[model samples]
Target: MFSTGSDDVGVRKAFFGSLVFETVEKTNGATSITTGIDNPVPIVILFVVLTIVFTMMQIIYRGLKQRRDELLKMSGS
Candidate 1:
């Protein structure tokens, strides 16, 4: 196992990299695990995407709650 990036939530998205391994004697005792893409760009992009989604959800919830509370208050009045 190999990792190339910080272990933090903020940057963990960039950790969306790859993993590589070899069976040692598979196709002929040769190399087997060779991959790339271990950066922070993907991680950051994912973080932003999630943040947007959560933010929108929170906004919608807040608006619905506010409307419900207002309706209840009006009915009480």
Candidate 2:
């Protein structure tokens, strides 16, 4: 049942099948791990979150500073 024709079709089929499988495999034989943010998503998200937090903090600080200055002026010398 292995012979597909009078010639060596079984050998040809096995060879082509192996080549196709190798090409279709996703891993591609990669076995090593990497560090320090392989993708941009985590770093980008962290930067965005920190930027927003810092901006809000600055806004609150400015507001409080203005209120404190106003109170000092109202108290007079």
> What TM-score, over all chains together, does every model reach?
0.53, 0.51
Candidate 1: TM-score? 0.53
- Predicted model with the maximum lDDT: 1
> Each model's RMSD to truth, in Å?
10.8, 16.9
> Model 2 lDDT vs. the true structure?
0.52
Q: Compared with the true structure, what per-residue lDDT tens digits does model 2 show for residues 24-53?
A: 212765333222323465556778999999
Candidate 1 segments exceeding 4 Å error: 1-37
Question: Per-residue CA lDDT of candidate 1, range 1-77, in tens?
Answer: 42333431121122445322222224555433334455657767888999999999999999999999999999999
Residue-pair clash count for candidate 2 = 0
Error of 1 at 24 (Å): 7.8
After TM-score superposition, the amount by which residue 18's alpha carbon in candidate 2 deviates from its true location, in angstroms, is 33
Question: RMSD (Cα, Å) of candidate 1?
Answer: 10.8
